[model samples]
Target chain A: MNDKVAQTVKTKGITRRFLIIFSVAFCLLLASASTHYFIVERSERIERETRELLNIRLGKAAIERDMQDVISDLTFLARHNETSGIFLPDNLDARQALAQQFRVFSEQKGRYHQIRVLDETGQEIVRVNYNNGEPIATSETLLQNKSDRYYFTETWATEGRNTYISPFDLNIEHGEIEIPEVPMVRFGTLMFDENGNKRGVLLLNYLGSTVIEDFREATANIADHAMLLNSDGYWLSNVEKDREWGFMFGRNDTLAEHFPDAWQRINARDTGQFSNRDGLFSFTTVYPISSSQGNLGDGLGSLPADTSYYWKAVSHLPPQSFSASLGEFLRRNMPLYSTMFIFLAASSFIVALTRFHHRQAVSEVETERSFRELLERRVDERTDELKTAQVEKDLVVQHLIQAEKMTAIGTMASGIGHEINNPLYAILGLAEAIRDDDSREQARGHAGKILSYTKDIAAIVRNLTGYARPFSGTEHKPIDINEVIHKAVSMVKRSLYDDRIEFRTDLGGLPGFSAHSEEIHQVFFNIIRNGVQSIEDDGSLMITSRYDGEKIVINVKDDGKGIAPEDHSKVFDPFFTTKDPDQGEGMGLYVVHQIIQKYKGSISLESVVGKGTTCVIEFPILPSVKKGNP
Target chain B: MMKQKILVVDDEESVRETIRLQLKSTGHEIIEAEDGKQAILLLGQSNSHGVSVIICDVRMPNINGIEAVSFFRRDHPSIPVIVLTGYPDIKLAAEFVEKGIFDYVVKPVEKERLIAKVEKAAIQSAVMNIVD
Candidate 1:
C-alpha cells in the first residue's frame, strides 16, 4: 500500500516533469542558435566581400581612367602644330614661340606639375612648370639636361609610334625636393616628322594628388579603405598614408610585407576578393588607364616601352561591413525571426514553468504531509473506537455472566431451599429440645448444635447473595482462581449428590489476576455445574488449575456421557446444548466463554462420544499480574 | 412395658441429634443411622427392641427417603414408616402417601408435634403387628 502511494507521488511529481521540459527546450535552443549562426556567418561574409570588391573596382577604374585622359591630353599636345614645332623645322624664333605655346597649354590643364620638350640630343628645348595651377616658364639656365633621365633615355628606345610612361616619383629641384614634396607621374610620347622621322619628345608631369582625390571620391560612401599596388608589389595606395608608395623614398616596403596573404592572392588573380580579421580585400588590375578598356600594348603606342601599365586596385573592408546582410536577414525573414521570438517565449515559459512546478511541488508536499497526518489521526480514532467497543462488550458479557449465575442458582433453587431448610430443621428442632424436654446438660449441648446449624445456613445464603450481587464497580480487583473455584464447587455440591456425580478438584496455588470476583466465581459455577449435569449416573467431575509462567490454566474434566465431536466446537456457543430443555439452559457454557474472553482468554473443549469431555480455559497473565511471592 | 425401638435416618448429624434429643424425653429407644440405606439395614437386624417406627430424611447421600419408604412397604409392611425431610413439596408428600407411608412431616416441626406423631405411628404399628 505504501509503495502504491509512493508510485503516485512519482507520477504526480511536478519537478521531474519540469526538468524534462527544461532540458529538452535548452538543447533545442542551443541547436537552433548554432545552425542559424553558421548559415548567417557564411552569407554575411560573402555579401561584405562583394561590396568591398565593387568599391575597389570603382576606385581603381577612376584612377586608370584619369591616366588615360592624361595620355590623350599629352597625345593632343604632341600632335598640335604649334607645340610640336613641326612647322618650325629647327627655326629658333618658332621654337621660342612653341615654348610660349607649351606654357599656355600647361596653364590650361592645371593638374600638371611640369611640361617640357626635348631635342634629339637630349637638350632642353622648351619647359614649363605649373605650380599649384600657376604656370611658370623656366628660363634657359634653370632648365636641366634630360640626357641621364630615364624618361628621356627610355623614350629613345621606342622604335615605333609609342608613349613612355615614367615611374611615379616625387619632384626634385637642384637635387632636392622643393619645400613641399610634389608627387608626380610623367606621360611622354615621341614626336614623328611628316616623313615618319622622329623629332623631339613631348613629356607631361601629372600631379599624383589627382589619383588620390579620385580614389577618395569613388570610395566616399564606402566605409573601408582601398589600395593600389604596382606590378612590383609596391604599395601605391593604402588607408595609412605613410604606408603608401614606400618605394618612392627608397623605403621599399612591398604590399607583400604588410599584407602577405592578401598580396599573394591578389598577385595571382586579375579580380578576386579575400576576407580576414582586418576585413575584406578585393582587387582588380586596372592597367594602362586607357579608354580602349583593353591592354595599352595593343594600341599604336605598342612598341619601345620600358615598362607596362602595372597597377592593381584593392578595397580593404573591416569585418563589420559583412554584417549588413546578416542584419537584413534578421529584418526580412519572418520565420527565423519567429524562431528567435519563440525561443525567447519558450525560455520565459520554462522559467515560469519551473516556478509554477516548484510551487506545485511544495503544495504537493504539504498535501502529502497533511494526508499522512489525517491517516494517522484516523487510525488513532479507529483504535480508540475499537477499545471503547471492547469495553462495552466486556460490560455486557459481565452482566450476562452475572445473569447466568443467577439463572444457575435459580435452577438449583429447590435443592438450595432443601439445603437451607435442613439446617433450619436442625436449628428449630434442637432449640425446642433445649427449651422444653431436654435435661439441663443436654439442653446446653443442643443449644451449641443449633448455633452451628444456623451458621451453615447463613454461609449458604452468603454464597447465593454473593453470586446474585449486582455488579456495580467497574474497577477490577485481584482475585485468586483457587478461592473462586472452591466457592463454585460448594454451590453445586448438593446438586452433584442429587445426580450421583462425584466431584473432584485440584486447585493449584495461583497468582491473583485482575478480575471481578463475582464474575470469576460465576464462571466457575457455570462450568462446574455443566460438568456435574453431563453425567447420567455415577460420573466423576474433575477440575484442575495451574499456572504456566505467563498464563493461568484451568481444566474441567468430566467422565460422563460425552459430546459428539462435531458438537464439541459449538458447545461454547450461546444456546448450544445437547441436553433436554428442562435439564439444561444452554447459556451456561456460553456465559463461561464470554467471561473468559473478557480477560482476553481462550477456551476449548476435548470431548469424545461416550468417553469423556474436558474443557480447558487459559488466560494470558497481565503485566500487573506477577507471581504472588513472599 | 417393652421400649419401642425407632429408626432415625438423616445425612446431617445435627438433625439426627435433634430428633434423638426430642425422642429421649419420650423414653423411646432411638437407633441412629446416617442415611436411609443404613436405617433399613438396622431395621433388618431386628434386635430384641424391635423397631416399631422409621423416620427417614428425603435428601440423603446413599439411599434417599423415597427409596427407603418403598423398601419397607414391600419387605417390612408391618412397620409404620414416617418421612422426615428438609425440603417438603406437596407433590413429594403425595408420592410418599401413595407408596403407603404412614405419615410425612417437614423439618423443624415443634418438639411436641414430632413426639406425638412418632408415638401415634408406633401405636398404630403395634396394633397392626398383633393382627399380622
Candidate 2:
C-alpha cells in the first residue's frame, strides 16, 4: 500500500505542472499571432486606399487636358486669316480655303462633330461635319442659317476676341433630340475683322465622349469603380452606361440618388480623400473651363471666366474591394500560425511525457527501495518519537526555567524593595522638613530634594518591574549588552552594597545583537550576583566587557572566596551551589548556562581556592547583528 | 546640655541631604557621610568626635550599616546606633536588636517616629556620658 501511494504521488503533481505550462504556451502563441494578423490587414488597407487616390488624380488631369485641347483648337481656327477673309462679302475663295482648313482639323483630331463660321446675322458661311471620323465640307447652298442657335448668338454678342464654352449636353438637331445620342460641347469665339471690328462667330462642336474616354484610359486600373459626375450630381461616365447622362434621360440614376452620402462630400470639396462604411472615396473637381483658360477675351469679353463649370472625377472602392478579407488573410497565414502552435504544443507534450515517464520509473524504483527499508523506517519512527519526547522534555525544562526565573525575581524583590524605599525614605523626610521648616529658603531646598528623590524611586520601580516579567514568546529585539548589563546592575546594585561588594564595570564598545533584554539581564544578573555572594567581606567585583574583533568577551572578576578546580565541571550542574540551602535554589548558573548556549555563547570559570574567581564569557557575534556601538 | 553632633550615613546623597534638612533647626550640629565606611572613618577621629547618635542605612558601599554597628558595639560602646533598612525583616531586626543596636527602623519611616527614635537614642547616649 505504501509503495502504491509513493508511485502515484509524484505523477499527480507532474500532470498538473504540464497542464499549466501548456496553457501558458498556448496563450503566448495566440497573442503573437493576433498581433501579426492585424498588422498585415491594416497595411493592406492603406496600400489600396493610396492606389485609388492616385487613379482619381490622374483621371482628373486627363479630363482637364482634353477640354483645354478643344479650346486651343477653337482659338487656332478663329485666329486664322482665312476666317477673317471668309467674313468679307464676295470672298468665295477665302470661304473655301477656311472650309478646307476646318476639314483638315476635324479629320486630324477626329473629335469635332461640326466646325462652322457664322456671320453677325448668325448664318453659317462655312461648315464642316465629322461624319463618323470622315470630314466633309458642306457647300454654301447646303450650309444652313444658325442665327437661332444659342452658341452663334452668344459668341457674336462678345465684344472682343473671346471664347465661349457651352455647358455639356446631348446634341439637339431641328428642335429634336439627335439620334445616336451624341454628347456635345460647343466652343465658340467671335471673329474680328482686320480693323478689330466684330465680323462673325467661329464655332466648334466638341465630342465630349473623347474626354470621358481619356478619363477612363487614365484610370484603367480602377475604371470599373471610377465615376465622372457633373456639378449637378449627374453621372457623365458610369460603369453602367444606362446610369450615365441621367439628366438627359430624366432618369433617377444620378450619383446623388445612388450614393447620397458620397455625393454630399464630393460636391463640397475640390479635392480630397476619405473612407467610411461605404469604403474609400477619392475625388477631385475637374474644371472644364477654369478661370485661366475660359477667359480668352483679353479684357474685352462680357462674361467673366466661369468657376462653376466643373466635373467631379471620383475613384471609389466599395467595402468589399478595400476591406481586407478575413478569409483570404487567414488562408495566407493560418497554416503557418497553426503549425507553429501545434509544433510547440507537440514539443511540450513530448517533453512533459518524457519527464513524466522518467519520473514514474524513478518513482517505482523509489517505492521498491522504500518497501525494502520499511522495517528500518519503523525503527526510525520509534527513534523519531523518542526525539519528539526529547523536544517535549526540553520544552518542559524551558517552562521550568521560566518558573525558576520568577523565583529568581522573587529573591531580587528584597534588593529592589530597598532600592525603591531608599529614595522613598528621602522623599518622606524631605516632605516632612518642607512642612515644619518655616524658612522659605529651607523649604525650597527640601522641595527640590523631594522631586529628585521621587524620580529616583520611579526609576527603581521601573527597573524592578521590567526585570520581574518573564520574556514571553521569545521575541528578540536589538540590544546593547552594555546597556543590559547596566540595567541588571541597577536591579541588584542596592543588594551589592548590602554585602559591601563594590560593583564596577568597564563596558567597551561592543556590537549589538538581537535578544530578549530580560533574558540577557537575567544571565548577567545571575553571574554578577553569584560573584557578589561569594564575597564573605568587603571586596571589589569588577566586570570588564570588550569586543575581541569577532566575539564579545566579558570578564567578571571577584576578589572573594574562589572555587576548587575539582568541582569546576559540576559547577554548572543544576542544584549545584556552595551557599547554604536557605541562600539560593541553585538553578542560577544552570539557567545561565542554558541561556548562553541558546545564544551560541560560552562561559567558563577560572579560580583558585582562597583567591578570587573570574567568570570569562564569550558570545560570538551573529551574522545578522549590526556591528558598532550598541 | 552641650551641643551634640548627629551623624547621618547612607549610600544615596539625597537621603543624607534629607536627614540633614530634617535635623537643621534642632540646634544639634549635623554631620553627613555617603556610606558606612565614611561614617566609621569620621567617628574614628579623636574621642569619636562627640557624635551623640548615628543614623545608618543597612545597605551601603564598602562597610555596610550592620558591619559598622558591630564595630561601634565593640569599640565605642557608649555611642547609640540606629539601623534604618529598606528590607524590614523581623528576623534581621531581632538579630540587630540582640546585637545591642539602639533601634531598627524600616525605610519610608514616619517623620515623628524617626525623629523620636533619634532623640531618644541621643538622650540615652548623653545619660551614659553623664553616668561615666
Candidate 3:
C-alpha cells in the first residue's frame, strides 16, 4: 500500500518533468514557426507592393509614349510643305490637296477626332474629321472663322516651330457639352509658308479615352486597382468608371476627397509607393507634352516644357488584397506547418517518454539500492541483537551457577552446622573435663583431647570454607580430580552420616588437568548431594575416578531410591527434582550438567526403580592441560 | 538422696566424658553411650536398669536423639530424656518439649548450666519413677 502511494508520487513527478520539457519544446517550435511565418508574410507584402509600383511605372511610361506619338504626328503635318503650297499665288488646289491629305491621315489613324488647318488669325482654313472610324472633309462654309480655342491660338502664338497641347477635357461641337462625353486632348503646331513665315496652325483633337484605355491595358492584371488622375486630382480613369472625369461631370468625388492623406503624399512625389491601414498606394506622374517635346521631328523645335501638366498613375491595393489572407495563407502552408507541428509533437513526446523512462530506471535502481541497504541494516541489527542475547545468556548462566552454588550451600547448612558443632561439643567437653579434673595426669589427657578436637574442627571448617567459596573468575589451574571429589564429598559427608547413608570413593591415580577447582567441586558436590538426598534410608554411594590416557572418567553409583525411567531424562533439567521444595531447589544436577558441558565433558545416567542409579561423567584431556602430567 | 545414675548419649566420647567429669562432685554414676542406638542397647541390658536420666545428642549416626527419646518415652516412661545438640534451633526445641522430653540443650553449653540441667533431669526422672 505504501509502495502504491510512492509510485503515484513518482509518476506524478515524472509527468510534471515531462510536461515541462514538452511544453518548452513545443513553445520553441511555435516561436520559430511563427517567426518564419511572419518573415514570409512581410516579404510577400514587400514583393507585392514592389510589383504594384512597377505596374504604375509601366502605365506612366505607356501614357508618356503615346503622348509623344501624338505630338510627333502633329509635328509631321505642320512641317509638311502642303500648307505652303496653298499660300502660293498660282497654287489654287493646295488647300484642296491639304484637305484631302488631312482626311487620309485622319482615316488611317482613327484616334484623331478632327484634323484641321487654321490661319494665324485663328480662322480655320481646312478641316478633316474622323467620324467614328470614317473620314469626312468639312466644306469651307462650315469651317469656323476665328478660333477662340486654346490649342489653335496657343500654336499660332508660339515662336519658332514649337507645339501646343490643350488640357484633356470633353469635346463640345457647338457650345454645349458633348452628350456622349468625348474626352479629348488637342495637339497643335504652327505651319510655315515656303519663305519661312508661319501661315496657320495644325490642330489635332486627340481622343483622351484612348490614353485611358492604354492605361487600362498596361495595368490589366491590376485593372481594378489601377487609377489615372489628372494634376487637378480629378480621376481620368478609375475602377469605378463613373468616378472618372469628375471635374468634367461637376462631381465633388475625387482621389483628394476620398483619400486625402494618400493624395497628399502621392501628389508630392513623381514616383513612389506607400501604405496605410486602409491599403497600399503606388503612383507615378506622367508629363505628356514636356516629355514628348524631345521626340518631335527635326524641323519642329517642340513646345515649352510644361512641368505643371502631369497625370498621376496610381495603383491602390486594399488591405484585404495587400495583406495576407488567413485562409489563403493556411491553404498554401498548412501541410508544411501541420507536418512540422506533428513532428514536433511526436519528437517531444518521444523525448519526454525517454526522459521519464530514464528517470524511472534511475529511481528504480535507487529504490532497489535503498531497499538492499535497509535489509542489510536490519540484518546487522538482528545480528547485534543475537550477540547481545548471547552475552546476556552467558551472564545468566554465570548467575545461575552462582545461585545453584548458594542453594547447595543452603542445603548443606544443617550438615555443616552438625559437623562444626560436633567438634565444638568435643572441645567444650574436653575443656570442661580438664578444668574439673583433679589429677594432673587426667587433666593433661583432657587437654590433649581438646587440642585434637580443635584441630578436627579447623579441618572441617577448612573443607566447608573451600566448598562454600563464592564463584569468582573463569581462570583455570591444574587440579587433582580426586582431591576435588574428596572436598565435594566432605561437604555433604556429615549429612549423609546423619541420614545413615554410607559413601565411598575409589580414586585411582589420575593425570592433572586445567580447570576451576571450585567448578569441579561444585559438579561433584551437586551429584553427591543429589545422591544423598535420593536415598530414603541406609543407602550407600560410591564414587570412582580414573584416567584412561586420553580422558578422565568418574562414576557415581548409589543404592538408593532410584529415579524412574521417565524422570531420568529430566533429572538434569533445571527445576526438575524429586526432593521436597524445602529440601532442594532442583538446580543441583542441572548446574552440574551445565558445568560439565562447559568443560567439554559428557555425563550419562542409568537407573532402575527401587534398585540403584549410576551416573558416569567423562572429560577429554586438553593437549595444553595434559602437558607434563604424570 | 542416693547418688543418681545418669546415662550420657552422644556420638562424641569427649562430650560423654565431660559430662561425667562435671557430675563427679554430685556423685552421679556417669554411664556413657555413643549414640541413641548404643543407649537403647545399653538400656536393654539387665545390668543397665539403674539409669535415672539420659542426655542424648541429636543428629547422630544410626538412631538420632528424637527417635531414641520416643522409644524411651514409650518403653521406659520413668526415664527422663534430655536433648543435647549443637544446633540451637527453636523449632526443634519446641517439638521436643511438646514430645514431653525433660529439657532441650544446645551443644557448647556452659558447664554450670549443663550440670544444673542434668540435676533437674535427674529429679524429674525420680518423680517419673514414682509416678510409674
Candidate 2 chain A: 10-residue stretch with minimal lDDT: A295-304
Residue range with the least summed lDDT across 10 consecutive positions in model 1 chain A:
A289-298
Candidate 3 residue spans exceeding 4 A from truth: A1-45, A76-110, A115-146, A159-163, A171-182, A220-225, A258-262, A274-281, A295-305, A316-415, A433-453, A460-630, B1-86, B91-104, B109-132
TM-score of each: 0.53, 0.48, 0.63
List the TM-score for candidate 2's chain B: 0.90
Judged by DockQ cut-offs, is candidate 3 incorrect, acceptable, medium or high? acceptable
B84-130: candidate 1 lDDT, tens digit per residue: 87655676799999999888888767788888899899899999999
Docking class of 2: acceptable
Interface RMSD, in order shown: 2.2, 1.9, 2.4
lDDT of 2 by residue, A1-630 (tens): 998885676566566667776788888887887787678778876776777888888998898788778777777788765335787789898999888988888999999999998888888899999989789999889988989877877777765665677878888887776878788888888878777778888889998888889999999989899998888888888888888788887887777787789889988888888887887888988887663365444443444556667889998888886455677877888889889978988877777778877877898789988986996898899899989997887686677567767777777666766877888988888888778878899789878877887887787777767777756786788889998888777666766447556789998998887788877888888888888888888788899999987789999999888998887998889988889775678888998888888889999999988888999988888766756775
lDDT tens readout by residue for model 3, A1-630: 999998897678767876787688779877886787788777888788888988888888789888988987887887774345665545547877888988889988888999988877777777888988888888877878757766766777777766677878888877877878898998887778666787877889998888888888898878989999888888888889798778876898888898999999999998998889769999999999788886664754455687777889999898988455556677788898888878877777677778888888998999999999999999999999999997897788778888988887776676667777777877776777777667899878878888888898889878767666776777888889898898788777866436588888899888887888888888988888878777887889999988887899999999878898889789888899888887788888888888898899999999988878889999899877776444
DockQ of 2: 0.39
- Locate the minimum summed-lDDT window of 10 residues in model 1 chain B: B42-51
Question: Between which residue pairs do clashes occur in model 1?
Answer: none
Off by over 4 Å in 1: A1-368, A383-391, A431-445, A471-480, A497-499, A507-516, A547-552, A567-585, A590-603, A618-630, B1-9, B17-33, B39-56, B64-84, B87-132
Cα lDDT tens digits, model 1, A1-630, are: 999996776555644565666567767766776577668777766666677777877887788778777877777777774244533546766666767887788778778888888877677777888866678777867767798888898876665646677776677777876547677788787787777777777888888778767876786656337677788787666667787667767886887887788788888887887777666778887665343223444345544323256677777766675557566665666577577657766765666567666777898899999999999999899989989988898777767776777777777776787788887978887777667854899788877887888888999888778778878777988788888888888778864325367778888878888888887887878877777777766778899999878888999999877888778778888888887786567888899888787789998888877778888989788767775821
